[model samples]
Every structure is written in C-alpha cells, then in structure tokens.
Target chain A: MKKDLNITPLNTLSLVDKVEMRITQYIKDNNLSVGDTIPKELQFAEALGVSRTVIREALSRLRTIGIIDSKKHKGMVLSHPDFIQNFEKVIDTNLLEDETLKDIFELRLILEMGMVDVLFARKTKEDLKELEEIVDRMETNNSESTIFKLENEVAFHGKLYEMSGNKTLQRFQNLLLPVFQYVHEHKLPDAEPYKYSKKFTTHRELLNYLKEDDIKAFKKGLSNHLEPHLDRILEKSKS
Target chain B: MKKDLNITPLNTLSLVDKVEMRITQYIKDNNLSVGDTIPKELQFAEALGVSRTVIREALSRLRTIGIIDSKKHKGMVLSHPDFIQNFEKVIDTNLLEDETLKDIFELRLILEMGMVDVLFARKTKEDLKELEEIVDRMETNNSESTIFKLENEVAFHGKLYEMSGNKTLQRFQNLLLPVFQYVHEHKLPDAEPYKYSKKFTTHRELLNYLKEDDIKAFKKGLSNHLEPHLDRILEKSKS
Candidate 1:
C-alpha cells in the first residue's frame, strides 16, 4: 500500500482561495459585464500581492466554471457561467450516494409540478406541436415495441421545460435529468414497481390539458403521471 | 484602452478542457469516493500524454469546484463539490442581468411551493417549535418597530426549507438567498407594492397550518404571503 503523504492541517483559508475571492470581489466592484475585459494576470498578481502563478491558477479556476473566458485577442472577459455545464461534470450517478440521488428524484418532481404556471403563460403554438409530436412518437413506440425509451420521457419533459420560458429553471431540469434517469433505470432499493396500468393519465392527456390552458387539469394530469415515482418515494420513506 | 492581444478562434475543445474531461472520467472509472486518494499528478500526466503543468492546471480547476482537495500528507482526495459555495462565488447581484435575477426570483417561489409535501411529511415537533419562535420574533418586531427585518423573513422561509428534509433543496434555497434578498431590497422594476395591510395570512397563520399538517391551507397561506412579488412578476410579463 502507498504510504500517506506527510499532511499539514489545512488553514481556514488557502492562498489560492483568498486570491479567487479577491478576483471575484474585483469583478463585482468594477461591475463588469459579460464582455468586459478583466485586468491582466500580472496586474492582479501585483494588486493581490500574489505571484503570477497564483493569479494564473485563479484564472484557470474561473475559466473552468465559465465565469471568465480568455481569448487570444481579449485577455479575460466576464461571462455567464454555464450552470448546466458545471453541474453536468459533477453529477455522475455512480458517484452520488443513494439518498442524494433520491433527493434529486424528488426535486425533479417538484420542478415539474412547480413550472405549470409558466407553461400555461408562455407556451407557444409551435411548442405545442412539438410536444404533441413527441407524445405521438411515444404512443407509436408503446404500441409497436411495447417499450418506451428513456429519451422519449426526457424529450417530452425537456420540451415542457423549454416551453416554461425560464432558461435557468430549464437548465436546472436538464442538469438533473441524468440522475432522474439513473434512478428510473436502476430501480434502486425502496423503488416501488413501475405503474404500467393504463388508468393513469398519459402524456397525450397532459398535452390536451396544456392545450386547453387548464392549469388545474394540467397539474392534476401531471400529478397522476408522476404518481408512480412519487408513490415509490413516499412508500419507501414510510417503510 | 488595453490593446487587444492576438486572438485565435476558439477550438471546440481546448487541451485543458480535454484534460478536465479525462480526469473526471478517470475518477468515475476508478469509482473514486470522497476521501479516496487520487493518483499523483505525474502519473496522470504520463497516462494522459500531457505535461505535468497541464495536469496541475486541470487539477487546479477541480479544486476550485471542491471536487478534489489536496493536502501535503494526503496528496489529493476526491470530494463532493460544494454546489452552494461555487454558486455564491459567481452570483454577484450587480453582475447578473435583471432578467436572470427575476428568473431566479420565480425559481425561489417554485421551490417554496414544491417543498410543501416534503415539509408536511418530515417536519418534527422541534422544527415546529423553532418555526413558531421565528414567527413570534417577527410578530414582536412588527408590533414594536413596525418593520420586519429581511432576516426575519428569510429565517421563517429558511426554517421551512430545512424542515423539508432535503439537504440539496435546502442548500439551493440558501444559495439563491442572496439573489432573493437583492430583489427584495432593490424593489426591482415591476415589483408590486409590499403589502403593509394586516389583511393577508401572517406567518403565524402559516405556522398554524403547518402545526395542523394542513397542506392546502399552508399552500394558500404561502401563496398569499408571496402574492405581492408574484403579482409583480405576472404583471410585468403581461406588458
């Protein structure tokens, strides 16, 4: 076995962390916009009393999160970090504990239910058509192969998230999709049996509710559609 | 004005990005858990056919997100990224566009509504007692100073999020708290007048609903509490 390296107790703050905090404060203090150029690395090093290497390391961290971008012509520009991209990197299903995964599962349900008002207000005719087509494809697949691909489920929900007209919320839903799918596929301990009965409302029914602009009916239909997973979580918790 | 540096068109993938992806994949493939020691930097450089500097840069990025922690004796250990900490770094209220901030405002509302089920299910007697005290504090402050500190409002809501028994959800609420506070303090464009009248359900009323395990009443009370902000958003969207 490899021996442990001689470790020192961690300081409450590391030099790199302090440098990162200083850089963030600089951006905020300057009120930098997406395309605004940040000061050069050497300037930051001098101002922060850190070495050029420390500044470079801090910049690399910022770039990793999409908060700052370095171009050949532009040294560093403030940019909106891709929250979804950063989240996707770390959301490996295998890496998460089961409780965390289940929490994500519940979060997805909450998001789907919570976005109904936006969906009713913001959905366009084209969005409806796209959703209808996805539901149609699901129906065809259900009848032909008697199997529904996970992508089909994701596509339908993804379309709804897009129609909600909240990009941040939509991105968050997309970020959680993988964990949602992982739970669905694995049927982890405490997962109830999938409800295959035809009595529950289908995607088409939910679409009809959406098309009618019936928020109540749509919420009802959605709750019915999501009941199996919700029931699984509820049942598991009770047991 | 700073002279533009000689810029090159960004490739779809940067070497650093590739290395980052490879490192993430390595962690997954190795099934590394929190506190598991990562392979040495030189070992990664040799395996990935990159220089040690590239490996160090990539590792720095991971450290920024809390995905890897390095200690003198421990070398590097895999760790769960603290989503809230990273988010706080980039969530500068002044830096965000007004639209994005508004979107966050709506997201907070959604989260609040969605958490009701979990709150009802998981809230303990002690949780109720704590919530009562917060509401009591607010009432006392309102009676004495005729003003509700924003901290009181946040404390009441924060307690509800905690009672939901979802750590991920609670952290998200905490992460978004700053943006929420920003909107509250600034009275952003389209914000409706804050209701000063005693006509609506008070926090104590909401607490009563929670005590009785009345989900419907709780939701109604919460909706009434949030109506001013919700009305503002809805009205703004119409125009």
Candidate 2:
C-alpha cells in the first residue's frame, strides 16, 4: 500500500489511548462480560489495523486498571475493575494540592450526608450491633478522651457504608478515607476549635435514630456529628 | 554480596505495585510538584534496589495515571493525574453488572442532590443566564416535548455542576455520565414511566428556585425532577 503523505493524523489521543477505547468498544460490541476471553494481541492488532506493540501497550493499560486480567494459561479475561486499584494509583496525598484535598474532604461530607436514606432503608440488626460496639468502644476508652482515633471514626462510618448495601458507594467512601485522614490529622488553615457542648450528638445518638428508623432524626444527628469537620471545610473555603 | 537462603521477600505487594508506591512516596518526600523533574530510571532503580526494567514498568503505570510524564530531555516529571484518564480506563459499560450500573445511577442522584447547597451558594448571574438559555432551548424544542433529550439533560445538570465551582465534584459527575447513560438507555429491569403531569416542575422551575436563591425549594424541585429515575432504581432493588 502506498503511503498517504497528504493525510494528517488528526487524532489528538495517543495511539495507546485510541487502542484502549477501541478495546472497550470491542468488549461492549461483543457483549463481553467478566471472565470472558479477549482476543490475543496478534488478533487484536490485525483486527484493529494496528501493530502488536500498540495492542500490547493498550492491553497493559487495561491490565493496570483491572479491566483485563492475564492468567497462567488464559491470555486475557475481562474482569471487574477493582475500584481501589484505580483510586489508589491517583491518591498520593502529598501530590494533591491543598484545594483539591479540601474538595475531597467536602466530597466525603456530601457522600456521608447523602447516604442517610440508604442507611436507614438497609440497616439490619447485625449492622446496628456492629455500629453499637464501635460507639461503645469509643465511650469506654481507658484514655478518658472523647476524641476519636482515625480508626475508630473509620470503623463507625465504614460500618454505616456497609449497611447501605451499595458496594459502589462503599468503595467511594473507602477512596475518600485517605483525604479525610489527611484533613483530620492536619487541620485546615484557620480551623476553629471543636465545640464540645452538651447539645452535640454522639455516635450513640445517631445509632439510636437508626435503630428507631427515624431518618429525619438520623440526618440531624449525623449532621451534628459531622459538624466540626464540615465547619472546617466551609471556613477554609471562605478564607 | 552473596545470596542468603534464609532471606525471604517480606513485601506482599507485587514488585511493580511496591515500586509504584515507593516512587509516589519519593515524589511526596521530595516535595515535587507538577513540572518538577524526578530522578532518572537508573537513579530510581538504584535507590529502590530494583532493576531498571522494574522501575520502567512502575513508571509506565504512573504515566498511565498521569502522575508522571516522560518528556524528551526532561526524564520523568511529576504531573497532576487526570481523573478522566484513570476513570475512562475502567468504565466499560458491558463489564459492569446491572446492579453496579444501578448503583452508579443512584450515585448520580446523590451527587446532584448534594450539589444544591453549593449551587445556590456559588451561582452567578452569568451562570443563571446560561442555565436560562438551556431551559429555553428545552422548552422550544420542535418536538414540543417537556421531556429532555439526553444532551439537554446533561447540559442542565452539567451546568449546575459547573456553577457549583468545585472542579473535583464536576469531574466526578462527568465520570459517572457513562453509567448514567447506560441506565437511561436500558432503563432498569423494572423501570416505570415518567409521570409528566402539570404539577411536575420543569427545568424552568428549578431555574426560578436558583434565581430566588431558594435552596430548600431547589432541593425539592431537584428531587421531584429525579424522582422517576430514583423510583426505577428503588424498584429494581426491590426485585
């Protein structure tokens, strides 16, 4: 075939990206599901009119994202992309700008607050018991400190996400944890002192609302629980 | 140096994953920001006690995530990771399960509902003008359809995200779009018809709420707008 010198490669996407898109389109067009086998490199290269090297690069990108797994004998199989794998790859806290970190903290609040309906709709006795244990552990801490360790906070909230029975939402909560931890450890600029007033509801109060299936009260309690952190985010943004 | 028989690899993470993590740690430890040059492959391999090939593999993974860029004469440079690059690599609709798709649709609702406060807080006159144009277009569509086309729907909601002035949240909304499209096109297993009654508020009404800066009313309007889609997800879950 004669080279077409006049034709410019108008594609702004790199060859690897283009190939990746095509592979995804291929999977969709073929109605391929998880565990389904994908074509070999040579076959893909020939089918897509690209070189084997391009195919290999695209497949490597796919494999990195967990979209296609390579087994001992199987060439390549479609797989459910692990949310953590992709999320963790981009979540180097030090690399993220301060504003981005704050945005993530805000996102955490949004997700937790928006989860009220699902949490109430799906809470079970077992879920409630686990949450109660976490709250009780906080209450009985020998240190006599009302402040929660990061793990304690994560356990209580993580339990709530699990009870929501939405794996996708749970994954989002897990992904946001690192940012939350960063913010919690290093308070935002101009962060105000947390008010330890009698009116503030603890996890126990929130749990009571969940137990009673009072979503309205649960939302109010949850908001009260998250108020200190939310205030920091709002204050930081204002300044 | 002689190899010792008693020595075992203590790290459970794959060599590539470990190297990737170490490289990220290196960037953080050195306080490297976007456009900052990182050490060469040979330097990293020596520092991390790994082969150049392994370092290269790890760097490749980082580059795919946009955490690092390999520029001519610049070696590896730290860069901001593009959310879409990593997100697009995994968002194969065919590979996603039906329940996962529904979960994503639900996530869209959560994000939109959560956006109300921000939208009202940050919305500007220019934003209102643009939104009014979109709503006007929707009203004047030749089909005389109160129902929004997918593009129109995206424009209205996308504009709201933009007006919220949170780039991270906007990116998230953009990333969830494919799954939203999938759900909209394929409607859930037990999807119901949208009740387009005279009482149902349109985008125009939502705009009026925004113009009046009535977040409470806007939330109610937004909820009503998303009601049918939310109903489908809730209905599908019941089955």
Candidate 3:
C-alpha cells in the first residue's frame, strides 16, 4: 500500500501528482480568471519550486481537462472547466465497483425527478413541438419490445432533458448513458402505468404549465409524473 | 473550438486502448478467472495483433484503475472487474464546464433525493444512534452561518450516504464538496427561521422515520428537508 506519510517536498509525489497539484494551487492562489493564459513553463516551475518535468506533467493533465489549451509554439491558455475529466479517469481506472454503480444509479434517478420543475418552467414552444413529434413517432411503434423502443425512449427522455433547460443536467444525463445502459440491460422491469398513459397526460400538463407559467401546479404535476418511476425504482432496489 | 477534425489520438493511446480492450476481451474470451496471469506483454500483444507499447499503455491504464495488478516481477494479474476504469482519462482531462457543473448539481440533487429510500431501508440501530448523536451535537450550536452549519450538515447527510450502502455515492458526495461550497457561497439565501429554532426539524423527522423504518414518511420528510435548498437552487439558477 502506498504510505500516506508526509515525505520531503522534493520527491513527495509520483512526479505527476506533485506537478498536477502545483498547477492546481497556482490556479487557486492566483485566482486566475477563466481563460487566462498560464505563466510560462520555466517561470511557473521556478515559482512553484519544482522541476520543468513536474510542471509539464501537471500541464498535460490540465490540457486534457480543457482547462488550459496548449499549442506547439504558443504556451498554455486557460479554457473552460471540465468535470468529466476526473469522472473519466475514475471510470478508466475501473475503480467504481458495484457500490459506485449504485451511487450513480441513484444520481440518475435524483436528476430525472428533480428536472420536472425546471422542465416545465423553462421549456419553449419549439421544445414542445419537438416533444409532440417524438411522442407521435413513439406511438407508431410497438410497445411490447424494448429494442424498437430505444430511439423513441431516448427521444422522449432527451426531450425532457432539453426541456429542463439546464445544459449541465443534459450532459450529465448523456454521460450516465453507460450506467443507464448497464442497469437497463441487467434489471429492466415492465413499463409502469404512467409510462404509457400519464406520460402523455403529464407531457400535456407540463407543456400547458409552461405556457400558462403555472409554477405551483407545475411542481405538483412534476412530482406526480415522477411518482411511478420512483416506486418502480425503489422496488427494483429491494429485489 | 476543438473541431473534431483537429483531434488526434495520443501517441500512447493506440496501443493502450486496444491492448486494454483485448486483455479484457481475452479474459472473457478464454473465461479466465480472477488472479489469472495474463500472457507476457510481447506474446499478448502478438496474439492481439498490437504493439507492446500499446499493450503497456493499456496495462498502465488498467493498473491505475485497479483492474489488474502488476509488480516488477509478478507480471500482470487480472483483478476484479471495475466499471470505473472508463473514467480515468475523463478525470485527467479538464473538460467539465458550467454546463457540466449544472449537470453535476442536478445529479447531486437526484442522488440525494433517491437516497431517501435507501437510507430508511438500510438504516440500522447503530446508524440511528450515530445520527442522533450528530444531530444532538448540531443542536448545541446557535449559528446559522454556512461554515458553522457545515460540520453538522455533512455529518447528517453523510449518515444518509452511509445508509445508502453505496461507497461511490459517499466518495462522490465528498468529491463534489468544493462545487457545493462554491454554490453555497454564491447562491444560497440567508433568510428567517433561524433565530429561534435550530431549524433542523426535518433532520429529527428523518431520524424518526429511519427509526420506525417508514419509507414513505422518510422520503416525504427528506424531500421537505431538501425543499428549502432546492428552492434556493432554482432561484439561483434564474439569477
């Protein structure tokens, strides 16, 4: 096991982590505005009291995360923040076991349920029209089989995500596609009643809520719409 | 913008991803059990039609993820199946942005809400005792300050995470702390209902529900507990 002792600063980290933390500290300490250009490599290393090799390793990670854009001739420029950078690493390390998967599963459910209020509040006419088209396409397909339902399923949920108008939530919903697939494939249950009947009812209600700007009723309807899925999910957890 | 056309695979990746995939595939293909020693790097690369560099990169990533263990002389031995291996590169890269943060926020909310059932279902006598102790300690403080409340707040919610019996969720809850701190610092409203009461009735109710094993009541109570924060979150989103 890797000991957690506080060793001397010289060779403390695995060279990579040491370098990475220095850059992180730089960003944090300098309060460098997003998109700011990072200091020159040799300068940064000198400032941090580390080697160029360490700085380079740290910068490589930052570049990977889109935090700093690196070019051949030019130095690093600050870019947008990226959260999936760490998530991807965690996943790549194959470290998230059954326990983590369950955590992710719960996360998906929470986001799905919480989105209703936002969806109704922010959805647009164009979004509603799109939903109608997706629902129409969905209605034309046979419902008994899941394979045929894949596209429509994504369409409906994707529309819901879009309606929520939270781009972050949308990306998260997309990222969870892998875990979602795993759960869906391994432990799928029958479509709850609301999934068929109330799906349209809730959609119409939600769209109307959006048009009318009924925040109170919208929240209620959102909760009601998600009630069935909550039950189904809880039941699955038990079994 | 990083045009997809501008993207090129890293030098180390060609051999790495394929080697990793092939190794996993070989294990499955050959029905190799855990503790199975993978073929020597060169031989394995030859069999999989790849270079040793690629195999090594793959092995390196896998090793990092804890899927396979490799020592100086022990060679590489298959470890447990880990799904999180997919996320290492993601984490290493700096791609999460505002949209992704929002997604993570919503995701955290979803996970928090979904955890209610898990909390109640899996609560033990000891768990309840520990929660009671934390709340009891929280009751001693009269401060409404976020920093002051943080200690107790984390304890109470951390207990909930533990009850969910999901380590990933627990670690994730910890991982997202900085983001949560950012939100609390920037967005949360400081309002009334704090001068007289400790304003943690919901936690008491949650404890009651956990003790009684009332899943419905527990969820309701938890939602009520979260409602204030959720309202503030929504309001913050607007502003």
Quick one: ranking by lDDT, best first? 1, 2, 3
True lDDT of residue B221, candidate 3: 65
Please report, as a residue range, the 10-residue window in candidate 2 chain A with the lowest summed lDDT: A189-198
Tens digits of lDDT, candidate 3, A47-156 = 87888876765675565444677655666777765545435444433334554565676667666755555565566788878877776666777565786688777777
Q: Quick one: best DockQ, which candidate? A: 2
TM-score of each: 0.85, 0.82, 0.68
**What DockQ does every candidate get?**
0.42, 0.44, 0.27
How well does each candidate reproduce the native contacts, as fnat? 0.40, 0.47, 0.35
Each candidate's interface RMSD, rounded to one decimal? 2.3, 2.2, 5.3
State the weakest 10-residue window (summed lDDT) of model 3 chain B: B85-94
Between candidates 1 and 3, name the one with more favorable lDDT.
1
Native contacts retained by candidate 2: 0.47
Please write out the lDDT profile of model 2 over residues A107-219, one tens digit for every residue.
Answer: 87877877676666667899888899999887777365444555687888899888878888898888888878887778576445545454788788888988888976876
Top TM-score hit: 1
Give the TM-score comparing model 1 with the true structure, all chains together: 0.85
Candidate 2 per-residue C-alpha lDDT over B83-103 given as tens digits, one digit per residue, 9 for 90 to 100: 555665577445666677778
Give me the runs in candidate 3 sitting further than 4 Å from their true place.
A1-13, A39-51, A72-74, A85-99, A124-126, A143-145, A187-239, B1-103, B143-146, B187-201, B214-217, B236-239
- TM-score winner between 2 and 3, please give it: 2
